[model samples]
Target: MQSSAKTIEQYLLELPEERKSVMNKLRNTILENLPNGFKEGIAYGMIGYVVPHSIYPSGYHCDPKIPLPFMSIASQKNFVALYHMGIYSKKELLDWFVSEYPKHCKTKLDMGKSCIRFKKMDDIPFELIAQLTQKVIVEDWISMYESALKR
Candidate 1:
């Protein structure tokens, strides 16, 4: 469910008590592994990590006013969604994650191009998630984003 909450704190407050711990752990993991220059905020009604305009003044090519998104987490109706832009935009990363995730995550994998869905905390591959997040630094991502635009 897309929350109307304006801040990350408010967003978490709106989630059910049962969901809070899982979300908080995921958030902390992301924060701990996130490369420098990614800032967290409420975007599209979910908690988003982005390359701020100060670092990438061009902003998101889809919408320049918005910052360049790197990742996000959302509480959806059926599952928690972890949106990984790197995996979606890069084929090699996606292949690596898909192949490596099952080794760490015991549950059945549920994922789209960018969205990794999990019904519970146990379904999450926290270690792989952290590794994936750490793989791309802000400058590398910006270079990738810019290259894609030229194509």
Candidate 2:
């Protein structure tokens, strides 16, 4: 579900008690692993990491006024979701994540184009997520994003 909260702190406060801890851990994991040049804020009603205008003045092509989104973590109705644009835009990264998922979690991979759903909060693979977060630096992500936009 999309949150109406204006800030990350507010967003966390609004989460159900059951989801607070996991979401916090996920947020921390992403923050610790995310490469430099990405800023953290509330975007699309979730905790988002984006390439800010300071780094990429062109901003998001979809909406030039907004920053270029890289990743986000949200507590959806049925599950917690990690949205990583890299995996959606880069095939090699997707392949690596798919191959590595089984090694980290016993639960079958539950994923969409960019959103990885963790239905079993206990099974959320923070380590794998950390690795995935670190895989793409800002430059690489911008390059990949730009390349995709051309098509």
Q: How big is the positional error of residue 14 in model 2, measured in Å on the Cα after superposition?
A: 0.3
lDDT of model 1, residue 16: 87
Worst 10 residues of 1 by lDDT: 120-129
Instruction: List residue ranges in candidate 2 displaced over 4 A.
Output: none
Model 1 C-alpha lDDT per residue in residues 31-72, reported as the tens digit of each score = 999988999999989999999999999899889999999899
Candidate 2 accuracy as lDDT: 0.96
Could you tell me how far off, in angstroms, the CA of residue 4 lies in candidate 2 after the best superposition? 0.5
- Evaluated against the true structure, the overall lDDT of model 1 is 0.90
True lDDT of residue 55, candidate 1: 96
TM-score of each: 0.96, 0.99
lDDT of each: 0.90, 0.96
Candidate with top lDDT is: 2
